[model samples]
Target: MDLDGLDALLAKLDRMDREIEGDVGTIVKNNTIEMTQKVVKNAEFTQGYQTGYTKRNIETKIVSNLVGKTISKSEHSGYLEFGTRFMDAQPFIFPGFYNQKKQFLDDLNRLVK
Candidate 1:
């Protein structure tokens, strides 16, 4: 068996891995931000900006290098998302998640390629 330039190849792969990690994190954070915006928009569309509480409460946070979150902090957010016995479900967050998912996936696929 003969091996040459394996160390250099490994070093290159390590660097590429690091770069990909950073890029993936950036993509996740950006997508979370966009998802937040989409959720707010959907809230507005579904709820008609009654008090603007949900829209204002929707926010994006980077939980870690590769993890991100879109949070709806309003106390009534869940009520509105899942609805109650008295009301039918008017889903903003779920719709927004579905809407932004394709873009997020495309962004990740593009990054990998």
Candidate 2:
């Protein structure tokens, strides 16, 4: 091809590379957050019974630095899940992650394709 046509082709390829990188990065980040949210929801649902306190307060939040995500609860929430000496540990968060781990991987895999 002539110099002009070759230059045009290179420019397009470079733009496409940049765009694909941006899109893939966004997709991965978003998918990760979504996966965390689903895990948190699973935990909430399986958290035994709910009077709307613990379950309602449960949250999935983005981690800093575009790292990933985290699941959290209100300050008093720790007591309900892990319990103080006066109470028993009900357990919720870890169990939720466990149940949804497979699905999380699946989400990432689909993004690759």
Candidate 3:
């Protein structure tokens, strides 16, 4: 291809990259949420903890050109994670990210390509 053609191709790639990045973030967020829900379902829920689980939700926010997603339980999520007086720690957050890394990259690759 000529230089002009090459330049046009590069410009198109850059544009596609921007679009793919934004889309990939959403895809990652949705998939990660599934993992979070599974972990929550499998978690050992006592009396109070069970109530807390009902408040679980996911949120997506934008910062400049980036999209950020959060899987939130409640204000007491930290207490459940670290354990309080009579309860043991039951982590449900970090594990949500376990399957997301590879899936995110895969989505980026598929969308960008």
Q: In model 2, what are the clashing residue pairs, if there are any?
A: none
Across 16-97, the per-residue lDDT of candidate 1 in tens digits comes to: 9999999998899898989998888899965636878778888888999888889988888887888889877788999889
Please provide, for model 3 over 38-78, each residue's C-alpha lDDT reduced to its tens digit, 9 standing for 90 to 100. Answer: 55653435333555553444343343344545545466667
The whole-model C-alpha lDDT of candidate 1 against the native structure comes to: 0.87
Relative to the true structure, candidate 1 reaches a TM of 0.91
lDDT of each: 0.87, 0.60, 0.60
1 or 3, greater by TM-score: 1
Q: Give the alpha carbon lDDT tens digit for every residue of 4-81 in model 2.
A: 688889999999878776665665566556655654565464333355555555554545433555455656657656
Q: Give the TM-score of candidate 3.
A: 0.57
**Model 3: residue 84 alpha-carbon error in angstroms:** 3.3
Q: What's the true lDDT of residue 60 in model 3?
A: 35
What is the lDDT, from 0 to 100, of the residue 60 in candidate 2? 49
Model 2 TM-score on a 0 to 1 scale: 0.50
Model 1 residue 86 CA deviation (Å) reads: 0.4
Determine which window of 10 residues in candidate 3 has minimal summed lDDT.
Answer: 54-63
